[model samples]
Target chain A: MQKWADNRAWFLILPVFLVVAFSAIIPLMTVVNYSVQDILGPGMSVFVGSEWYKEVLHNPRLHDALFRQLTFSFCVLAIEIPLGVGVALTLPRKKGVWASTCLVLLALPLLIPWNVVGTIWVMFSRPDIGLAGVTLNEIFHFPYNYTADPLHSWLTVLVMDVWHWTPLIVLLGYAGLQAIPEAYYQAAKIDGASRFAVFRYIQLPKMRGVLLIALLLRFMDSFMIYTEPFVLTGGGPGNSTTFLSQFLTRLAVGQFDVGPAAAFSLIYFLIVLLFCFVFYTTIVNLGKGEAQ
Target chain B: MRMKKRTVALLCYLIFLLLPIYWLVNMSFKTTDEILSVFNLLPENFTWANYAMIFTDPSWYTGYINSMKYVALNTIISLTVALPAAYGFSRYNFLGDKHMFFWLLTNKMAPPAVFLLPFFNFYQTVGLFDTSIAVALAHCLFNVPLAVWILEGFMSGVPKEIDETAFIDGYSFPRFFTTIFIPLIRAGIGVTAFFCFMFSWVELLLARTLTAVNAKPIAATMTRTVSASGMDWGGLAAAGVLTMIPGAIVIWFVRNYMAKGFALGRV
Candidate 1:
């Protein structure tokens, strides 16, 4: 089994490493430099140590936005995970034109641009002319203006995210479901397992890996959501829809506050890394348990 | 018996999924007056003016073309780089291989917004600001990791015995890869390309920040339409519908590979 090999294969990976580093690492280093200093103008800076970090941590705006972000991500996970699983369970297992049709239809929403999804929802929720707003008011006689009402604004944003992203979860879940061997189901049937028992024991355990990936992907994407809320509500009826990403953008681009925004970004990056690490470890341990 | 219930549930899901898309298509076909007049599933009067405006105008169509150019370029560049890297990782162990793989995956996790300001400055200093190339390169930061991860999964699934067999048959590495390995993982490449296209196509914030006028993507063009002369609903709807075409075509082509792509990290 031991064979001497020419090491030329390393050449294959060089182009990718170079591209990723040029695009990602160099810019990241620049951010780290900015985070540590006060940039008054071009070529003028004063070292501030952790001053920017302290300021960002204590800022009430950051606090509020972080809270909103946490809540929004949690809500997205709560709703989309179960909804996706339910939809996956319902998909026909056999391959045919029916399967093809379902696949295409489910993927339609995902293909639309994020900003366009926001625009569509914004127009769709207009009280005067939009379909959703008009129908809800006409049927129930309840006034709904997402632009003017904070609750409606949040609700609209949540519904829009769900509409755009739930298909991703379903697609992932379906893939996992498809990979399960028919023998497992046959065994369950012979054992006289009930529908609930089959799902609880076989399907759920089999899906844990894909479900974890779905959860983490949705969590990160939802946490970093900016364009949808930006276009839809413009981050408010009084800042009700301002998530952390929008808040960071407003600081860095809107006010041109380079130092604090850089620090804020680092903190934001760390939080995401921490969550991903936790998710990765937990799933790996679960996988090990299953292997055992 | 169980099949009947599954069919009913799928029908409901399909309706829920397609309703908004239907609404968009419906609005795209209507006159502004008709759109404003009432809420109906079907337009009172249908017109092609929206589509005409997008097709005829340079400002409108340019955004579409610019987006397509960068998206296509990004997909090509990402795959070309990722194919080799993924192959190397799957087939050989080298200096810092494990660490390098982890580092690449970590890059994918970094938030794009975090790097926006720095990227602006970096691209400007390097004479790449406001160009399609800059946008395309910025996208590679994330897409390459995804492509590598996905391709590696597929590559691992291909048995090592094939490689040994090819080598014993006097096939060079490149020839074997081109003739044997590539065909085996064609589905994986399709999936990787689909993801690269989808993410780059829909991305707005970086695409907006990097380009000012010449290379403005359609996603950025939406912002301008809002600020210019009274929210041109017709123009915006037209642009929205047109922007959807590339993505729809991509999904149509790769519909089969999606199940494999979605199963990515799980496998």
Candidate 2:
């Protein structure tokens, strides 16, 4: 649909602009202010331009955390996207008790508080008494302990994330599926298209929009994940599960290195923006290429 | 055979989803000793003491009220502002519209942990500290942008011809929006509200930081279980179970609408 050129439309947007600006800009400015200064007390502060930024940039821990954050986010997207779409495809489409029940069950994980999610998973994976831990050790005869083993810790965090967030993708994909007009399916049937062909042609293309939103949302959220991993592993066994947010939280809140923490925060925010920009443009350009 | 395969796959996935939840529920029904002592599929000594403690205690129950209060407030604010903003983005080629949209999302990208101190100071300075509205407004940092993004996708699906027709028929913009346009996208609104409620309800860091006592959220209150003594696994699990109730109720009310909501919006 072609949109009209209308500057008057700003009237409609002014409210949101004000609300977001009021909430976002002030705190942002504070972060920026702290990023450049050395604060000792309430009124004792010294200007330290670029000093904190340089220290944060060279920090070895930040580098490891950033690397881990990228890997975790990549793994999350790779696993959750396909798995969520597959689960959504199998969901009962017809509205009834079964469909409603599936929808409600799918939604349960998302509503739990982040800390509670971590706690639940923590108990659920305990080697002594937890189901997953006991089953793996006793029944499956696997040497798995998230607390002591870094690989297990990584796997545990990854699995925890998938369990927590995959529902979001399923919900989005299911909504996209629900939107496909009945006529499309009817037309496909009339043409005698194979199930795979119909899925490849009709369903996948229609789901592109929702899937894009899901991709961006999941990427950003996973990249910034903090509370769950913090609670689950305490960045565990030796900072193995620590992501970017937890790293920054340790610097800012734990160590109270205000300037460096603020500087690192800005860099962290930029990295996310850069990735989102790349994704938004790449997918959008791909769509344009297909259109052309 | 194919239909059976699909059913099996779905059931398997659902079982995977429910197992942890089942464990939480299982723990909730047992004593702390029972939870810690043995691996039980079902509670050995079924007790409602965890639930009983929460109901009898003011601290635990008030957390639920506080969470609900802010979540509801945030959802209402997000929708009210986002409705008009989304219409503008969908219908018009406004200046810097694309950039503005992207900029809005960057707020969502900001790590909440980093912003905690700033949010604490900002809210405290304006004297909105420890109020439900503080958390509600703080939540809008993310929820408003999300609401706009979702609503824009839905609004773009409504053909321009409908708006044109409404205008030609002498309906005022506000009246057309309220009477015709809103009903058409009620499902979208339902989905958006659900997202907003979910995000606000589950968030702990910002919610915990912004409010100390009067408006402390249930998620924040759950931290009380971790104090000096050993972990209160039963009580914590019980609170976790209770936190899910409000969101589940909201989802039930919006289930039908949500089934159809994502149909229009490109989002």
Candidate 3:
């Protein structure tokens, strides 16, 4: 919205700026300070130039974790997007008791605290006590132990994430669907347009805005996922479940490799920034190819 | 048959969602011995001791009180600050606005783990450590940006003419904002507040780090209970179920706003 030149708008923004700066900027400065200095005694330390960055870059564990992280994020997006859209499409349009019930039920996973989600999954996948594991192993004879099996652990985490997040996409897509006036559907029906045609031309196009947002949000979140998997696997099964943020936590907090962790954190932040730039551009530049 | 297919898909998904939660609930009611030893789908030997224990212990119940305090504090603080900032972005063409917006969002992008250590040292040095306000302010880092983002989206959809008309009618800026502007975007406020609450409530790392006893969250409390000689499974399970209740209640109250929020108030 263009308006008269009013630098005074910054006054309105001052409170937010102050609060965020207090919480974000100061801690960021500490991280930058820690990245350069090597602590030895109470105050004695050597100034390490880019030595920590060099060392962190060459670390094989980081390479492996980065690869796994990329794969996991890709898998999350690939699975969640289509599944969320499908569910959203299938959802009833009328705002009635049934729709609200579904909305509440669907939101249950998203509302639960992250650690509780981890706890639920950990308990539910326990072969000895969990109904899920026991049913899979004893009843269906499909053996699975997330603690012992690396692939199984990865798969379980993926399943848990999907269960937790797909509803969000559904909610967003359903909202988009709700925003579409009934006239368009009626027009489509009168024109003898097929269901797929109406979806492709009308619904999908209208939903694109919300879907793109949902996509970026899910990507950013899944890329930095930590708490649930940390609780579920503790980055175990030979570090198979250790994603980038978890790996960064291991370096920074677990081992107290502060210098290396700070360096790695900058690198990790850049990667997320790069992805955001690309996604932001794509969203802005959409519709050129499919304007028909 | 077509309608049934859609219903079935939703049913299957709902069942998948509820199963794990059901497992947690089932464990919460059973005795610790029953929970650890059996694979019962339903609690055959249900007990009330787990729920009773949480209510009886100051440490247990206080965890809930402490969490709610910080989360409520963060939500109120975030929305109060975010509303005007969102209006500024949505209504005006201020210099460097785009850059500042992205910079705000970067806080949301930064992993909480990266700030875990610095936050502790910073809060402690400032003498705010172990306080509910400490956790509340720390949560504002991410929540403020998000609150602003959602509110800005909603506010943009509102015509600028309304502001002009209100001004012409002799309402001061603040008066117009609260009386006329705010009620107009009440849905946006509801959505933004709901989100801020959801996020601050769920976050653990900073909350756990900032609080020693006075503000220790239920998530941290539950996590600690895992390291005993015999793990308090039932009690932990009760705490888990308890954590979900506030969120459930929130979703119920904001159910309609959520549809609009999901569509993103334009919150």
Model 2 segments more than 4 A misplaced: A181-195, A282-292, B259-264
- When candidate 2 is compared with the true two-chain complex, its DockQ is 0.68
Q: Provide a comma-separated list of chain B TM-scores, one per candidate.
A: 0.94, 0.94, 0.97
Docking class of 1: medium
lDDT (10s digit) by residue, model 2, range B1-267: 988999999999999998988988898999999877888799989999999999999999999999999999999999999999999999999889989888888888777877887888899999999999999999999999888987887787789999999999999999999999999988888889988998998898899888989999888887656544537889888998898788788888887766444332553
Clashing pairs in 3: B153-B266
What ranking of all candidate models by lDDT puts the best one first? 3, 2, 1
Backbone clashes under 3 angstroms, per model: 0, 0, 1
The list of candidate 3 runs beyond 4 A from truth reads: A284-292
lDDT of 3 by residue, A1-292 (tens): 5565688999999999999999999999988887887877667878998888899889999999999999999999999999999999888888899999999888888888898898899888888888788889998998889999999999999999998899999999998899899999999999999979998999998888889888888988998899889888988899999999899988877898888898888788889888987786676467344443
Q: Candidate 1: where is the Cα deviation over 4 Å?
A: A1-10, A283-292
> Top DockQ: which candidate number?
3
Against the native complex, each candidate's DockQ, computed on alpha carbons, is 0.66, 0.68, 0.76
User: Residue A181 CA error for candidate 3 (Å)?
Assistant: 1.0
Residue A252 accuracy (lDDT) in model 3:
79
What does candidate 2's lDDT look like per residue over A154-220, in tens digits? 9999999999999888988998888788999999999999999989999898788778878988998
Worst 10 residues of 1 chain A by lDDT: A1-10
